[model samples]
Target chain A: MESESGDKYAADLSSIREAQMRISSYIHRTPILTAETLNSISGRKLYFKCECFQKGGAFKFRGACNAVFSLDDSQAAKGVVTHSSGNHAAALALAAQLRGIPAYIVIPRNAPNCKVENVIRYGGQIIWSEANMQSREEVATKVLQDTDAVLIHPYNDRRVISGQGSISLELLEQAPNLDTIVVPISGGGLISGVALAAKSINPSIRVFAAEPKGADDAAQSKEAGKIIKLSQTNTIADGLRASLGDLTWPVVRDLVDDIITVEDKEIVEAMRLCYEILKIAVEPSGAIGLAAILSNNFKQDPISKDCRHIGIIISGGNVDLSVLWDSLNK
Target chain B: MESESGDKYAADLSSIREAQMRISSYIHRTPILTAETLNSISGRKLYFKCECFQKGGAFKFRGACNAVFSLDDSQAAKGVVTHSSGNHAAALALAAQLRGIPAYIVIPRNAPNCKVENVIRYGGQIIWSEANMQSREEVATKVLQDTDAVLIHPYNDRRVISGQGSISLELLEQAPNLDTIVVPISGGGLISGVALAAKSINPSIRVFAAEPKGADDAAQSKEAGKIIKLSQTNTIADGLRASLGDLTWPVVRDLVDDIITVEDKEIVEAMRLCYEILKIAVEPSGAIGLAAILSNNFKQDPISKDCRHIGIIISGGNVDLSVLWDSLNK
Candidate 1:
């Protein structure tokens, strides 16, 4: 499964398996947690894949570690670069730090202070850009040219997709009887990998994408039978504001069974539930899977209505207390 | 290992092993979690026994489950009663609900709304008393006389101590190489049970009790080699305000290594660390173990200065968000 750089949709079970083996020494095999209270709340037995406990406080570390370590010595010596104002930035920084290589992080000017601090704490070289996708990409491109460093696209790279797919490899074996998996959709790297590996291992396992209604591009794309870009997006789940990438979109369009959208308020409530009942701290993006399970969209869906055992990938837990307090207060 | 009704300190390794077997079906064998960031922060390898993920969102459930299930069918039909305004009350209610028996919880009038809600959710019959020990005990005595229900002392009973000791049994097996265990001190049920079981399994393992400076009665008692009662106590860790019971005092005097007292600010900081780094929601009482590990009292201790592997029992995760928010803002 050594995919060519140009192959956007090359990630499969073999690639995911390889990624797992490669990153096994670096990443944690996070525990699966269950709450009876949550089970009764959803009327379905739910198993939470606690990626929130992963290194860098998100599942992004798995992909980042795999990509950084997969590099040959020559490329590794040249270092790596990425433009991310979220978990991926910190994760890439940490992964590079572990490999004793420099990380060039291009962050948006308005990115949360806590996230920026994480990059600095991990020894990443900061490169500021205007708070726009264009500005971020332009800055990243300049950094790449100047430093002669390898660019690791957060969710769009084939290496990253296969790396994130490792989650499914561990999860399926942990909870072998899972009838379905609910994943939070951002750039779709997480869901792309999850769907590919889970379906490959168990063809009947339903894969549903959980999206914030404010950032409903994935839902629109699903309905339109193609990738639909949004002009504007709004969501409290900051990690979920990204549009689906070309590599991830094809997988979502083909493999993802359905897309369920939940409002920001629903996502907040899910976050609170995760804290109070499950005793697990989860960022809003990580809690969207629980929100989707409790949403009417999933409850009324004819195909998945009777799925007994459900697995929710809690994607990350890297939010600021002030931000969380504001959302909970609202 | 079975003790008579009047026995208060009959808990031994056999009793703890029996309790583990009896309650195995009802309680969770909580996972051991580790964080590299935390390890570096404290300059030691730390394994966290996540009792916060227990059935009632605390380790209290283990004892409550054991106490409730150890009764004969006739005694179970008579139900159980306890006077507690903390995790123990809710734990008892939930355990009783699971066993299909009535639970009479005598809560102080000033108990937190969230804790009261938990008792109500578990269908415990609430008997409100004045916010004082005398009133709580008097009301509990009346309830026992009227309903013919057995009284389950929160920490002073043999069954509860042995039940809590199951934690050490499981922890010793999970992290077999741990040379030290740090436990928070309240009424000393948790630490008392932990010390007994941990020392019995490995005589060389050191057991340290972590206490809040505001409620340093445990430290004073250890110094005086006798139980010491505080006229008043003040700490944000509402759970650790209780003094050691007569049954627990002897064990803390003999088997416990030392008592480390930390400030409320330290506990809050540890709570923040638990949420920020470990991604675990731990109450102030639960975070005290980490606080002690980071405190100068433990770090500078001559006896335990060189201990490598340490186990921390995170006692509970039942604090209100508003309470947590206020503490963090401070």
Candidate 2:
């Protein structure tokens, strides 16, 4: 796909570097944990960058902080608005509150109570929307126009992509010689940033994007040599269920080496492994990279030997306990 | 008990210090995690010493390494023997193997597969016994006699206590002004070592032994002024079910400031909070110290202001997933 059209697949990573500079201090340099047990089992080294311990319980804070804090004084006074399942809502709320700005979050009515409470606790105004893409987008657009508030899309924003890229910058700095990095892809903000950060540092570094097969829009898009919309997205990893957004799509299309798909069952197994062996509580989405690695999904399509020092990004830890409790009970 | 006998708990601490000097290369000085969330909720700065990330999956490695390396030329040839539910079993096996010594582990047949597999993988020979205290002890004794192996009791041995003492030594060194500490007590090795180390550094540093009410043998013995046995011990905390051992009770009865008992439900709740909030997976036994603090089970009921900087020893992270799966299921 890249060979057919030069520069078509490349991301505008210069903007992402600027985003990193903007929100450097607001978020944590979340630690990377290399799994000895996993390494031993696979006969290969495995480094896990744990973003599950991120502020507001996710890497969403990076993008949110960047988006909110980058606003002009007039915009800050006018407030900001966004729609999210949960993490992004809380992240944006905290981000806005820190800058002494009002945050108007449009959350799905069926969102988890803990998440809704987190947003409210952080002093964000909540607007309940129907739990569907059409309703959420429509309500967010209406709210944006009604109040003239700045709309911060969760992804599909150059600023958000740049903010999320900071994770890769830190990971590569910590494990500079890493050969391959596998990350869970949602709407492409994180992967776009990561792929750019890694490739920019060393062109040899292979980037693998992990997504649930049910939500394999990015993988399909990459194969089809352009964006391909999916009518249906089914996944336990709520974070990775979305199709790639417009701004994110071009970046992911050009930069990401490969978009890999895995079954949700593999993600569950990986989550359990993280809980059992790694002694870390990670959400299903957070384990997608691990799921890809451990499920032997990569073995059939082997990573090059230069990429022997593999790193996988664990995206977030805003896990729903009821689902985990149910799985544990079973 | 100490008043009548005029005998205070004293560890052969010189042995411990010497072991610390020798085994410094083998063990990790696990980091202490401080929590703003916990401090706010508990009204005290809680320093959690995470040993879950320790090699051999727990603080058992410290004791195991001390015991194995302390062996004379003759005993090293004969190898070492121990009976344990799991953590110590694997620790001793790995520690012994590292030194080219064989490990004979007598394990209850009912022990979880994860632990048994860890022990086996660490090159230990497992001698399965019936799932009863009598059978476990009897099988271990027979194995020791048959093999002429050195018996490294999980907690009763002097060297084992000394090894566990290093955790407190490190904690105190890391946070010097801490006025009080909470140590989870099982066979009492961890708390015994902790009490000795804390008192030696600063006699004013109050040390509390946090024991599960289900297996309140430590609490019972503290009141009885002698070692007391449990008729039936049932707790999700497999780590805290044992009574204070021979070497531990004397030390615990005297040097320790107080003994506090928390319930199984409290332990479970504390585990959940640690897993959820701290993004750390803690076994129920490891969560007892936090449980005690959260429940306000203290002498003054509130952790004293003098004990403003409180240290908690999370002794191990060798969690069994099946058990956790069952627990979280409930």
Candidate 3:
């Protein structure tokens, strides 16, 4: 649905459906995994949409591929540019590479070595930025202006949001009986897209956003009925530190039924459980949905109380092994 | 496909096919995972049959379910017994529990705490045995005699072999164009079952056994044309310590095309790769096939030379976290 402000960057169900067709061949239709242990623990049948197994090890690939492929020939010739030090950087880089297009990544100088290596491996040109978000965006804007490269904003772009919405299309088809879908909200593109597509398909299907307690701008935004920006954020789930974007805020506000917040300790515990029981190495951000469930963050919600079957989107698997080792050791 | 001496405990392709049908609903038809990174590293198209995602976290569940379900109501009434500290113990326990039958597991006193907990959690009665094969066997035998429980040998029995063979049936269907099937060998039940079924389906398909360099009894047995016992075996792949059994030896000799040995270091490296790139937690035993490929153990073989598509059966994921952490840290 279009935003009340009539913003050009608003995604609806039809746009997401188009995106699904556009990126079908370029992306993997990741498998849905189920574990009896996880089901018993949450007291509900949980279907895990394993986006961690997706190409580039995250669901970001869908949005990246869609954004890269949507560019017209002349527009694509100039290449694509993005500012991200997380899965989105690697994903956009790989997506651009797959399309035989140049990708300029504006990454913080202090970004993890592995993440930077991932972008480089995908043939992305790295333009170092200061560690702060403002500096990163400024560098990306300068590069876009200088090189005439297309700016593929991580979450603010309509194409990217629509691309991510394809997940709910596949998820609904995969598990038609799911009563609810729990998604991790970062800049909120994924959850916004998912909520739109899921609600459009099944209005009764509840969509819940799972936020890290350390950086809960989305939760606070839902409570205040307005976007809330955090001055500082701290969470092991580094991916969920971003505040809600303008484009995503409206979608999340309209379509999301509830916002559940889980602490860092809960995220780590859920990550450990995922590794042990699911035999899948999920990043802390990816395990937030499980953390929300385990922490009983949705216990009092009427929709969640009636929910017998739930679908959890595992956001990514680009975890630092040392951090995992430390948490597991502890 | 029967033993040369026509032993009662001999599994053939037909029996395995029957087992597949028998345990179809009881066991998960595990997914086949593929990674571009893994394929590039191995220089071959590798289809990983992830039995790590199987019921009870291993392929052993297929055999256990088949065995438990195959028994007559009268025979099942007396319950089942086995001696194991690996995936088989938990698999059998869960299988028996599904059938509402008692499961008695005789585990070595020094077995990993996690494994002991797994068996107990599955509602299996635990009988502590000394840390020796003979003591385990004696304790299991005594338990069977005292409780009138039928013994379900891990890898030596016909029923179990047939059940494990079912994996090949699924694997072949999942990746029908595989030129070679790589399996980890311990007592050789899995390989025997896989080889018999795979060869019976397509004689042109090469079946290779991946064994730990420290526990190369299968390789020695193949070379000597006799079942050779190891004086002492040592490897990070604890699941592959057992020597080839009489029932499985004949099948391996008749059907298996080659035996490839990999070092513990290679196994650990492959295990780490699985965790990192595949986003799956595979035990050292499960990673041996990849280790064999990575170590170039089959580089000279004509069959392997012609093999473009190789199927690797990930044997299990029942790894001790502490052991995995230590190995990864090191």
Best by DockQ: 1
Assess the local accuracy of residue A283 in candidate 3 as a C-alpha lDDT between 0 and 100. 83
Rank order (by lDDT, best first): 1, 3, 2
Ranking by TM-score: 3, 1, 2
Off by over 4 Å in 3: A2-9, A322-330, B1-9, B322-330
Deviation from native of the Cα of residue A314 in model 3, angstroms: 0.7
- Per-residue lDDT tens digits for candidate 2, residues A1-330, read 132245434334566677778888777677666556778766678888888777777788898888888888998888999998888888899899889988899998877776787788778999989988789999999999889899988888767777888888899888887889998998888888787777777887888899999989888899997788888788878887677887777767666787778988888878877876667778778989988876655777755344578898988876756643343334
Sorted on DockQ, best first, the list reads 1, 3, 2
TM-score of each: 0.96, 0.89, 0.96
lDDT of 2 by residue, B199-226 (tens): 7778789998788888898888888988
For model 1 chain B, where is the 10-residue window of minimal lDDT? B1-10
- The residue pairs that clash in candidate 3, if any, are none
Tell how far residue A82 is off in model 2, in angstroms: 1.5
Q: List the residue pairs that clash in candidate 2.
A: A9-A254, A10-A254, A16-A162, A179-A307
Model 1 Cα lDDT, one tens digit per residue, A4-112:
3444465988889999999999999999999998999999999999999999899999999989999999999999999986799999999999999999999998777
lDDT of 1: 0.89
Docking class of 1: acceptable
DockQ, all models: 0.47, 0.36, 0.45
